[model samples]
Target chain A: MSAPAKLPRWAELGLLPAVNLVAALLLSGVIIRLIGESPWAALKLLADGAFGSQEAVGYTLYYATNFIFTGLAVAVAYHAGLFNIGAEGQAYIGGLGTGLVCLWLGAWPFWVVLPLAILAGAVGGAAWAFIPGWLQARRGSHIVITTIMFNFIASAVMTWLLVNILIKPGQQSPESREFAANAFMPGLHTLLGKVGLAFTATPLNLAFLLALAASFLVWLLVWRTRWGYALRVAGQNPAAAVYAGILPPRVTIAAMLLSGALAGSLGLNELMGAQHRILLDFPGGAGFVGIAVALMGRNHPVGIFLAAVLFGALMQGGSQLSFDMPRVNRDMVVVIQGLVILFCGALENVARVPLAALLARLRGEKEAE
Target chain B: METYTLIVLLLAATIRVATPLLLAALAGLFSERSGVIALGLEGMMLGAAFAAAAASAVTGSVWLGLGAGIATAVALALLLAFAGVTHRGNQVVAGMAVNIMVAGLGPALALAWFNLGGQTPQLEGAGQRFLALTWPWADAARAAPFPGLLYAELLSGHNLVVYFAAALVPFSAWVLYRTRFGLRLRAVGENPSAVDTAGISVTRLRYQAVMISGVLCGVAGTYLSTAASAGFVRDMTAGKGYLALAALIFGKWRPYPTLGACLLFAFTDALATRLQGVALPLVGVIPVQFILALPYVLTVLLLAGFVGTAVAPKAIGAPYAKEK
Candidate 1:
């Protein structure tokens, strides 16, 4: 019954997450083997596909941009001690907002539509999340269950709207018409070419930069502000927060609103930047991936940024691996994502005890010397 | 007479649909009643569905498939226990991990094994799938008309698993209320420290409860692929597991009330299917999506209204640790 020693900040933030990631990857490798494939060969191909070319890197960053938006969404809600699993629905609604604005104002210049689209996206997502947030805060409803229900509700609503109301006239598919060229989100390559820079064509766009900017803003809002402080206090200790005149209900709602708005930005990249049309499942499970990112990143902006890139690499590379290996598929990445969530989030303490004991022994040896 | 017959058919469908939900809700009843969050019910069912279907396809035996399903679900339940119970980690996060993992793992393995794009080969023939059991002398009874048709149509022709699910509810009530294990399980959920002090191991009781949950989910999932549908498809459970969770909550964690909720939800689901593209006199054609979304919307409303006052177990979601 030895008491575990406390970990230093650096080890706590960096080393522990790194060790957990390695463990997750090892389990993933075992899964790869179980599927009758060589994990090493698959890893090599995955690495090459993710980083071998400028095009691959761009794709990775493009996927990373979506993760960043969603990762921050989860991180913000986590900080407020709320598990806002409705990010998927929020992102879907947010995409709807972007699509509506683009369809209605396609005649306008890019500059005019972009800001309005962004605002609409955030508002749409926040509106979708508001119901669960209000229910949790004012009515004592469990956020997790309510949010899960809302995901199905959102899916049904989106399907109905797309199939019946929003489908392009005379088209057999359940998707809207493409946006005008003026309304298109300029890709990084196109924007770079205009400035006389030689860059390969890819889907990477200004939203990537927007995601980084959002990360910085999240850090500011979550750490540097009074409201942020109050939010943290409320999450950490509700009784103390009440004594300090911070209302838990208010914080809960506000945090959910912010989280939903951030999640809404996923559409800015997927719909506005890539698809340019309203389609089914545009969020593409990125909202769920964000939970993994947030957990791995320890709910910090910088960590989330790195974790999002790692997931983005997996997304980009897994597709590449699927092409090379007939037996392996992109779903393998999801298996790894689950492992990461399991090792890093659920079984986090499984590693902590051993690491602490090892560190204590090493420190003792150094002191004796 | 046509309307009456249609109503009877609808009732039959409701009973059929309610089978899986009832099984899963009872599964959840065990886990949550023991203070462990059973959010991974969806994953458990999916894993079992895939295992049952795949095993049946390979072995050509329905009983083997049943065994495989139960084994897979029990393994997943143990994993949840390792994470949520032994490690004292966040139960919700652990459940989500199981869900996400199974979602990917099922398809990945399916693609690798069968090369059929995440689907097992369809279960064919008598031994590979569960067939409906006609009650004894059902044809002779049908000749009597009226109540005979009702008995023949509604009660007589369900697969064995459906009957098992129906019977399991009373069995569950008996086990939950009358057994000493149930008393200890309930005591642990309500106050683990008290139970711990009473010379009982909280972890063991919780583990037993969770394993029982797994077994029930296994049966439910097998019933889905083998009895309800032909074989497992990707995400074939669709939202049934979640619907069961909602039913569990709606019932306030009781067996009989939970069965009522499942039947109610199933009835609505059947009505949605029947009402599709059918115009009504006053309401016109209600969107099928709206009807499909009703159960969820109702659950949310219930949670928000005064009815949401349903109290959870005292130690629910709290990781129990002895005083150091």
Candidate 2:
């Protein structure tokens, strides 16, 4: 095989992702056309719907908050060489934690309930993720398979709990009672309104700020800490880590714990932040979206924030598009998500090879000049 | 007498329910045995289910639907091959992309074409579905007592796919252990370097395995839509592909053992359906959710070596770049 050409950092981080996004969008346009709609018109509507007004931006940010939590969750595990697909399940269990705290202490002040709720959510998510980590580390089972299994198990467990035990008395639907006003995560609009600043009410909440904080903490934990270095080393090369006296199994367990905790934070945004109660399927495929976010973001916190926002835009816009253009629905966004995964994750090198050649040619010209 | 009839009916229902899983497990057996992770089995099945249901609904021909399903699944498998075999990308990630893509694409396309909220129109005419075929002398044998119940209820009436699935286990066993192609396919999964040294193209063999798996998955999906139900429902596969994957691992990647695992899982599913609200005397009312989750729980335990160890193909999930 010939030696492969290399590209600069700008091309690596920026141009490559942009190329992939374009490829995904172009294909999405084809699907849109296949469904008998003009892709340009749809694109226009989508952009307008996502960013045309303050309310749209608020909803976009609201959705972005959930993506950030799950994206960080996935990124942490990816760094540890573990494919933790159990984020959906962990988020579900985490919501249960948040819900329990809120239901029991709904009468308490916001300050007292919020801290405990966050802690309970993290602990719940981490605990759920711990089993898969332990199994992979000690029992020789594949973490991917175990995590996928846990997602289903989580669904089943939640169903049983909700239907049999936790369903609000005399209610037919499988959901918990509403959390008290004190327990609700105040919406951003409401909070902003108190400061003499006016904004349209949306689901956007303080959890968006919480998501930003989580992203920064993850950056610190994954890049700045000694444990983070060990985790990265273990992920990149187990043999090298072992040679350097780092226990891979321990790192795997720790990474999963952190991943699960990050995923668990999703509930704070969706439940305490928006819905204000636990419900079935509240994760609503955000865990899977996190995979796409992490992949598109190249597993970086900064990249994740950008990718999460883009996806949030897609979510907000796609829903609006579906309302106007009945032919195109929210599933169109799912199709986009899948194409993004395909382009960014699976077929990542498709654009890289050609782009590398181009860069190598440019360098050759520069040398000759 | 009533209880005896119900037992026979339940056993028959078990066979019906097991068909799709058995086919899908065999499909995974082919792909994973060739060293490519078949996580996209769910996606392939879902895509084919929608294709089959749509074609059947449109053309009113079950055969066309079957053909369409196989073609769709083959196309998907080829995409998997391109990413996994040709590009040497992460097999798990690629497989998952296929799944997630189909999960959305199927529903989106369905809504666009049929406009029934991500569902195909109901298949009605006789030609649109694979109706159960009663065996010769089925009615004649129903007149007897025990023999009648066994022959007519337990063994006779089932769609063609169920019979094909039953016959497929022994056929798969023969092909795996007895055929030259099977040997090479298995060898490529175990050690592609050895296969490459022997002048066999690892890529071709892996692609062939994936294609075969895709066809089987297509049939499984077709069975779900055309035979098991009258129309395609959104997310109708409902993790059966995963269940089949679990069964594949539980069976230790062997044909007969995998069939047994499928049967066990199917029996549980049948039981879950029957015991949905009924309370038993000794066991009391078992949660249907627990029964539904049993297969996943058992597979995890099996993988953990709590019960027995399942050794995967050595070269599985690793991209083979030919040595210089």
Best by TM-score: 2
My TM-score estimates for the predictions, one after another, are 0.98, 0.98
Cα lDDT tens digits for candidate 1, A121-239: 99989888888999999988899999889988999999999999999999998999998877788899988999999889899998999999999999999899999999888888889
Deviating ranges (above 4 Å) for candidate 2: A1-5
lDDT of 2: 0.92
Docking class of 2: medium
What DockQ does model 1 achieve? 0.69
TM-scores of chain B alone in all candidate structures, in the order given:
0.97, 0.98
Q: What is the interface RMSD of candidate 2, in Å?
A: 2.1
lDDT tens per residue, model 2, B1-324: 888877888889989989999999999999999999989999999999999999999999999999999999999999999988887777788877888889999999999999999999999867999998888999899888588878997788998999999999999998988999989989999999999999999999999999999999999999999999998998999999989999999999999999999999999999899999998999899999999999999999999999889999998888788954
lDDT of 1: 0.90
RMSD of each: 1.7, 1.5
